[model samples]
Target chain A: MSESNLMMHHYLAKYLRQERMPHIWCEGCGNGILLNCFLQAINELNVDLNKIVVVSGIGCIGRVSGYINVDSFHTTHGRAIAFATGVKLANPELEVVVISGDGDLFAIGGNHFIHAARRNVDIKVICANNFNYGMTGGQYGPTTPLDAWTTTTPYGNIEHPFNLAHLAAAAGAVYVARWTSLHVRRLKASIIKALQKEGFSFIEMISPCPEIFDRYNKMGTAVDVMKWFRLVSQVRHGCDPAKAEITENEILVGEFVDIEKPSYGRLLREMTSRVQDKLKREES
Target chain B: MVDESRAVLTGTHFMSGDLACAEGALAAGCQFFGGYPITPATEISERMSRRLVEVGGVFVQMEDEIGSIAAVIGASYAGKKAMTATSGPGFSLMQENIGLAVMTETPLVIVNIMRGGPSTGQPTMPGQQDVMQARWGSHGDYEIIALAPSSVQEMFNLTIECFNLAETYRVPVILLADEIIGHMWERVKIPPAEEINVVSRKKPKTPTAEYQPFKPDKDLVPPMACFGEGYRFHATGLTHDEKGAPETVSAEVQTELVKRLADKIRKNAEKIVKAQRVMLEDADVAVIAYGIPSRAALSAVREARKKGIKAGLLRLVTIWPFPQELVSDVAKQVKAIVVPEMNYGQLVREVERAAKTTPVILLSKLGEEPHRPSEIIEAMRRAVK
Candidate 1:
């Protein structure tokens, strides 16, 4: 590629760690598309890059933290949300975001996810729901669809999958949305909305794990999976997230919940100020 | 920044060891506390929840010990002095993230108020069983500083020391208290803020463009750069080079990084290690102990001296990077060493390792009550024989 063509095509180059580029994502993996959408969202917002800290847990999507140019942390498996909570609560001025995988966010880290959402911490969570544990060779995970074939589930996945949108909404996320990797523009728009929200916001990006999960489940090639996403996707704004489940025939996509309340950091600051004022009055 | 006046609690007061530990953290300028409620350590969290507010700090009661430690590490990386308190079971849950803190070189403190446990063997009782786990709990080759406080005063003083060691070395420091000291109410003198010694993590002096997050100075410890510092650096649990990018496949990177993580504490063990030597100047028998058992060991040493047995005490204040030189020196002079622990013999193994040819007697006690002075004195008598 010529320098001019490279400059034109890789406009989001500034948002990535160029030295670490040619990421670890497999060929035809949707992780790149998801990353592109996220970077585009960040680019469109034009926020101070210094203030953003991206944290990720263990998985293919977890590598996103390492690839991002900002101050990032690739934390332990299933701990991105918990770690992000600490970061956001410690310094409210820093915009803490967690980008991790389904197994990381739900299976091993399920309790932390719910509790962080329940506390309404002011952090954005972007979960790349590739449906199985992609990094660990497509073992079945918490979000693995029932009857889906995986490494651990040779015959079929018997475990019930979590409807992540419903889980986020039920666990008290102030903003919730879901989009497949095929919906690039809409996903980018939704990411921007989630980023702008003041309280806990969650956006589930249904990505394709072509080399591992799709291969085991016979979902054809990565492009074929993208076509499958297009065939089944339906946009529903402000619908009850409880009704938004990903079945073979239909995958509910779009903004399902958006509301506002005092975030954990805001309430903590309020309480601290109130207590400090009380102490002052007592001393005086 | 904390208002120094509100933080110190600056006076003599009667309080439990757990409360004193919390107050000590406040005095040390700890601005973030993430913890879970567990036996013998719950009071620390309760006190932190109330006091962290007055000092304008953040206190979060996480869902579990794993989340608590993870949050503590997160808060530390965001440039706050952070800590969490738990007992054995919770400490076990915290091991993985504790290792994460070690690899990422995040500074934090963990106070484990130990209870009897292979698995919840005792809850309302004291034990020194977690000492070995504190050293090797996380599955990796890294060194951590563990301080054992024997009294309410030491609980307060050593909790502050935990923070200082953690910040200065950029490693997780464990305050190994036990049920006896945690719940025991006693007088604690909180010194004025200016008189107190507090250490903060060293920040990078180099320009942002030239910064390498894991590049150490002559001290073998790197200057930390927190999130939102405009450094735009990245850190991970995976073995990485000086640049802090993940380099899992490189044998040299793994060797260099892991060795530094251990050597940062090992090379500076002399400065980090602390212990109280009592009457060991001319003694035939030496008693080695820590935490609650150290108090009994002290009493036993005095009792043995009264009986003309020439017994003395080597009370370990810093339990990890195991203080081998101190034990070896004492072992050479003494005829025999007596190790009385609350568990089925944890640190006794360390004493034996350090004692070399010197006979090391293990007086292992298991129960709700600590070893009686007579029991330890009896062991001292047998050791001298």
Candidate 2:
């Protein structure tokens, strides 16, 4: 939106793309931009890209692993979080990042995400919420806005879109934030903070899928779709659940939550030593 | 669960496939086992958890089969010979990550003591439905070295072989066992330490700086560096170049990656493939069998000898890499081949393919119950006549 933000976006895109895959995501898809923001965050944070593992589930956004030049994994649908958690717990030294689409993370693997966050695993999850199934022919998903027309829900969406940031915060995610693709700089900062935080951190990027979601919803252009994102979203920080409303053309996106706690890796080590101590006492 | 007696001892006793698998992992120098309990294979997780700790190793019960394999792969990447065991259902859950190991060329052992399935078909019962799935379970074209052991000893030896093959090749090896072997207890001897040849994955013999995780070496299997190791190499499930970074998902990368993956096993198939032949020096008919059915076939052949039918036996010690050429050559000399299996005509196709001029017959039973020696005898007599 600003000249500085455009330069920031341009700078972020430099080191993110693989030569073979200049662009695998559909045109007007925010996945590439989201990936750019992630790269900028990790780059700005000065992480060892060698030790940084960008894990993704199977989807358009999941292909982020394929483009990122890291020790990444393009895992099976909904299992990236589980795999990333294993990778994190296995070494505890590697910086693991799970970049998954809303459908990839929420619908099938929502349980794993919650449990992992609850345990405070030292990993950052950057979830791209396009509010519809952008891949697989624009089907209605868990994050599909209420009353949105989709291939599966032709008449209207009957299900409520999950307020993912709120849920992550509630589930013991030490740091949590939500931002639209429009605010790439803020999202980048949020990701950097989440990556730096030594516990379970979650960031939801309300991305636009102009080709699929926009066409299906009869929204004409990317600009209009972004406008809808701005209008529908309540900029309510400490955004109370009781005040949450379901209005057509309304969506919520901003830095929703942030905090800190002992990471799962830390607690696990503690548990291991405690057991070892107990065994020693009994033996003595 | 703590076998305070330690792993360095000679033992002969009845045990299921799971316990035998655990001991095999231990003897193979596996110090880490991460898995979850799934039927026909729960004993493996339980035993591995207990034994790994006693051996000053690590056993982590991950949340699911996916996590189980993930943890083991991570541990393997951490410079440990690691493993995880599960059954058909869990194996189904593991297919995706199995592909991850395939693409990453991660060295680990997975014991698939198969039960019936498309999904949760027969958790406790025995089945060989995973025969086709084991080879092509992961969505890719690569050579998977799966070994099927007929007896408890096969389970023990095959488990060790699985690890050795995995480490030597830097690829995941499957101990394709069954519920019967997994649950049955039989005498087994832990191999003497002096005789046991443990192969850790080939570390970079060159300067660590020149190491590429997915690059083919002289043997086609590239030396892999552990995670904590200073060598900086990236691993991805995506179609990767020699350096283990994601390359284009095109025909070229696919061709190169798939060829390398398949070639690694194909090049070493001779060294990896194992099987057994009995009474084939002068025989008219042969009993082609593996797994529990082979046990029956062994008995049937002994009875056929008493009857003077010239019925020999060809037992497939390695279920995968199929022992086809050997079977085919052996089959040409015989009049007919009797294939008695637990599943309905699963291995019969292989026998028929192997036996060109000879009659290739099938005696199959699809039941919760296993095959009887008499059933195989009846088939053998029919073939001989």
**Best-fitting candidate, measured by TM-score?**
1
lDDT of 2 by residue, A1-284 (tens): 77545644765544453343556687777887798788788778888766777778877888777666566666667877777776776677788889999998998778778878887888889998887777798999988887899999989999988878768877888877777887788889888888778999898888778889888888767778667767776666556533443346555555666666888778666655665556668878
Off by over 4 Å in 2: A1-21, A25-29, A169-172, A215-235, A240-263, A274-284, B1-14, B31-34, B53-67, B70-80, B117-119, B192-194, B205-212, B226-240, B243-249
Q: Each candidate's DockQ score against the native complex?
A: 0.84, 0.27
Model 2: share of true interface contacts reproduced: 0.24
lDDT of each: 0.92, 0.78
DockQ of predicted model 1: 0.84
Candidate 1 is graded, for docking, as high
When just chain B is superposed on the true chain B, each candidate scores a TM-score of: 0.99, 0.95
For model 2, what TM-score does chain A reach? 0.89
CAPRI quality of model 2: acceptable
Lowest summed lDDT window (length 10), candidate 2 chain A: A240-249
Candidate of highest DockQ: 1
